[model samples]
Target chain A: MNLVLLPEQTDSTIWQINDARQVSHLKQHLDVKIGDQIKVGVLNQARYLAEVVEIQSNQMIVTPVEQQAIPNKLPVTLILALPRPKVLRRLIMDSVTLGVEKIVLLHSYRVDKSYWQTPFLEQLDHYIQLGLEQAGDVIAPSILLEKRFKPFVEDRLSVWNHSQTTFVAHPYTTDVMPINFNQQCQLMIGPEGGFIPYEIDLLKENGCHIHHVGNRILRTETAVSNILGRLFCA
Target chain B: MNLVLLPEQTDSTIWQINDARQVSHLKQHLDVKIGDQIKVGVLNQARYLAEVVEIQSNQMIVTPVEQQAIPNKLPVTLILALPRPKVLRRLIMDSVTLGVEKIVLLHSYRVDKSYWQTPFLEQLDHYIQLGLEQAGDVIAPSILLEKRFKPFVEDRLSVWNHSQTTFVAHPYTTDVMPINFNQQCQLMIGPEGGFIPYEIDLLKENGCHIHHVGNRILRTETAVSNILGRLFCA
Candidate 1:
């Protein structure tokens, strides 16, 4: 854990850690002791250099030093066809780590209906926390689920397209990404089997310029992280 | 499987699929029947459009129409700290899928020694085949293992830097990547805990320019794919 996350407090600078995993990381991995300074951040708030004040077997107390804001979230709204449950977990973590501002779980013609019923979907916060802990960011990106492909593309997608250049990952397209793209944009990635020709046409009608990464087909998770890395200034 | 992989056959146009999984994929997923055309490639050789000639419950036979050369591999070598067995498997597949020319797994100070003893290393061909099948390519990237850090950095790393730009991923470094990077280059990614300061110093002293992806700490696999995507023309 790069930054220890703490619950928000009204008027106090002191924070307490009780999560077993975080405590274990602090004690075992970091080997922190009293008076040792470490990075800590409050959920959805600023990060701070916290000095450990008290230590116990189960808990520890730390006071914040000067607070600093987190890194800016990338101005990209990710529209992904819902991947299988196992891949979805990794995709979510990597997307959040890359600072995607918003994520929309989209249903396409190729997406299996049962993939949307995974139990992991109910525990979104748990996966988001894993991403936040890795990125050392406090803010969680907003996630929206769209089960129907046609209506969402015809109606709801315009909200995401407002002032944003939309690009869809398609294999045979001649479109190329311009270097130094800083404007807000929407990137759509299809599922394992890829979007059918009909689905691609619908996305095109909705203003998504299709682009291909390369001849090699990447997994959903790899494609997401790689595309985000390519789009953002690294 | 984007491209079904076939075993090498000498002076023969017919190929037999006996692998149960591949057979099942053909029957169930692709639903191939007699005379159905499918993409196929011999291991480390040319790709072909194969038409099914015979079919059975457990196996199938196909004849190649015409052989075509595979796409060119990316002009890059990847030097990575050996991750744990689980992540290592995915990293190998993803690297090969991204068309890395070479991969060197180096041992850093923080890398757990047991990670090198994984049984997965023995079946490296299986993993490479999966990657080749995914990427629709025949050639597999060469893999090398370096167990000692200091000696390799001082001696062997220079060979990699001879004609190629050498870059090591180091967070907080001011070095920025050049856009439209088409030249050959070597990329080094560290282990989970990252390289210690001494190792970073050794790498820099050996003509490696340190560059960081971002403030977020990416997992070894995610970082590999993301950085490769960012560095290459995807």
Candidate 2:
């Protein structure tokens, strides 16, 4: 973890960290000690230099010392086809680390029905928090689950987020992705086997520009990171 | 697996897959049946549409039906700092799937010494093969291990691969990476805490450009995919 992100803590209050996972992580991985200055950020707020003030078998305390500049999150909403159960946690954490402000896990024809049943779906917040910690950012991207693709694409996703342009990643497309794109947008990436022709057609009909990075087909997680990096240069 | 990669076979020869792993995968995951068409590729050769000629309890036979186009590999050599043991496998697989033609797992100050002791290092071929299957390509990229950072940087890496420009990833750098860079290059991505200042200076002295995607810090795998996508737009 790059940063220790705590719930919104005001100055002058003792910030206690009692969660078993975090406490163990701090003790073992970070090896925190008293008077050690650690980097921290408030949720959706500013960063600060915090000193480890207290440590016990069950908890630790940190006091914010000085404010630090927070890196801005990239203004992209990742619309991903829910991936395999095993890759779900890492993908979510990576997306958060990449600074995506929002994510939409939608159903596709190529996506396996069993994938939606994975218990990992319920632990999205855990992955998101880990991602935030890795990125040293405090804000958590809101996740939206869309089980009905047609209705959501036609009635909601197409019309929502007017300020952000929608971009869909398709490796076979002739339209190469734009470079130095300085605008907010939503990007749709397909599942493992990729979106069937009909699904791609629907996405196109819903006003999303079909874009290709190059000739190579990338895995869903790879495509997400690649497109985000290419579009936002982040 | 998008393609089943096999050893070089002549038109008249019967290609047999008797390996337990491949046979099990074909029988279970692929559900390949007799007379079913499957995508297959030759090692470092052409791709083909093949027909399942035989499906025994323990082995499978496929015959090449027609020749197909093979996607071009990206002309980039990735220089990555040794990552954690668990991540090593996925990183190698992902790098190959992303089309990196060469990889150099180099030592860095931040890299844990024990990471080099992982048994996964010996199983690199397995991950590479898996990546090839995923990408539907057969050519395996050569992986070079650089255990000594200083001498390798000064003696070999700086002089080797003159055809490829060296681009090092440094998030703290003031120089934003160039957009629309159309060149074959080698990208050096740092490990978890990133390359130390001394290492960055040494890299600069050895004619490496310190580049940043953005202000945010990204994990090694994310950086690898992001850099490959941005540099080659792939």
Candidate 3:
């Protein structure tokens, strides 16, 4: 974790840490001691320098020293096909670390229905919390679950964020993504087996430009990070 | 697995499959039947369309139908600091799937010396084979191990492949990678904790221009795929 992100404390001057993971990390990895200064940030807020005021086996306290500038999140909304439960955990964390603004998990032809039934989807907050902790960012990206592809693409996508350039990653497309294409991007990626031709046509009709990322086939997790990195990680 | 890669057959027209994993994948995933055509590639050679000539419980035979086009590998070379054992296995597979031409696992100040003792390093061919199956490519990138950083940078790196544009990913550098930068790139990435100031200085002195992805710190696996995607995915 790059920054220690905590929930908004009632007293802005000092923050208390109670989570065991955070406490252990502080003690073991950081070797944090009283009067030690550490980089800290509040959830969905600005970063700051905080000095350790108190330390104990179960709790620690820190007081804000100075405000620090917060970097802007990438202006990209990701449309991803839901992956298996194991991959989803890492995917959420990796996406958050990449600083994506929003994510939509869409149902697709190849996506297993059992994946949607996983308990992980029901308690998304826990997963998002893990991602937030890994990224050291307080703000969580809003996640939308779309179980119906046709309605979502035909009825809703047209009315959604069209200001951003829309793209759907397809293997057959000869056109490569333009370098440093600076614009708010809405990227759609398919599941492991990829979208069928009919689904590709539906996405195309909705104003998505198809782009290819070389010939080698990538797993969904790798593809998501790779696409985001290619599009926005300048 | 996209393409079933096999050793070169002296008969030049027929190939036999013996691996249980490959047989099961073909039968269950591809649902391949006798006379069915499948994409096949020879190790480090050309791709071809092959027809299943015979099938049994444990063995199968395929005959070449015609030669197929093989996609070009990405022209980038990667220099990575050693990661932990588990991450290293996945890292090698992910890098190969992303089409990197060469990899150098260099020792650094932040790298745990114990990581060098992993048994997986000795069985690297197995991991590379898995990556080939995932990407449907046959050629494996040559991996070089540099246990000493100072001598590797001062004595070896200077005489090595300097033709490619050299860049190291650093957090403090404000310079973003150039857009549409078309070149055979040599990218250097640090370990989980990142390169210390002294190591960064040595890299700079050896002609590595520093670049930053963004403000958010990324884990080593995420950083590898993200950096590759940013550099050559287009």
**Best candidate according to TM-score:** 1
What CAPRI-style quality would you assign to candidate 3?
Answer: medium
2 or 3, greater by DockQ: 3
**Candidate 3 colliding pairs:** none
Instruction: Provide TM-scores for the models.
Output: 0.96, 0.94, 0.95
Tens digits of per-residue lDDT for model 3 on B174-207?
7876544546878889998789999989888887
What TM-score should be assigned to candidate 2?
0.94
lDDT of 3 by residue, A38-119 (tens): 8887877767889999998999999999987766677888899998888888887788778778999999998998999998
Interface RMSD to the true structure, each candidate: 1.6, 1.8, 1.7
Candidate 3, residue B122: Cα displacement in angstroms equals: 2.4
Least accurate stretch of 10 residues (summed lDDT) in model 3 chain A? A156-165
Which candidate, 1 or 2, has the higher DockQ?
1
Least accurate stretch of 10 residues (summed lDDT) in model 2 chain B? B156-165
Decreasing lDDT order of the candidates: 1, 2, 3
Interface CA root-mean-square deviation for model 1 = 1.6
With candidate 2 superimposed using the best TM-score fit, by how many Å does residue B17's alpha carbon deviate from the native?
Answer: 2.2
Ten-residue segment with the worst summed lDDT in candidate 1 chain B?
B174-183
Q: Provide the TM-score of chain A alone for each candidate, in the order shown.
A: 0.94, 0.93, 0.94
Q: Residue-wise lDDT of candidate 2 within B40-68, one digit each (tens)?
A: 87777778898999988998888889988
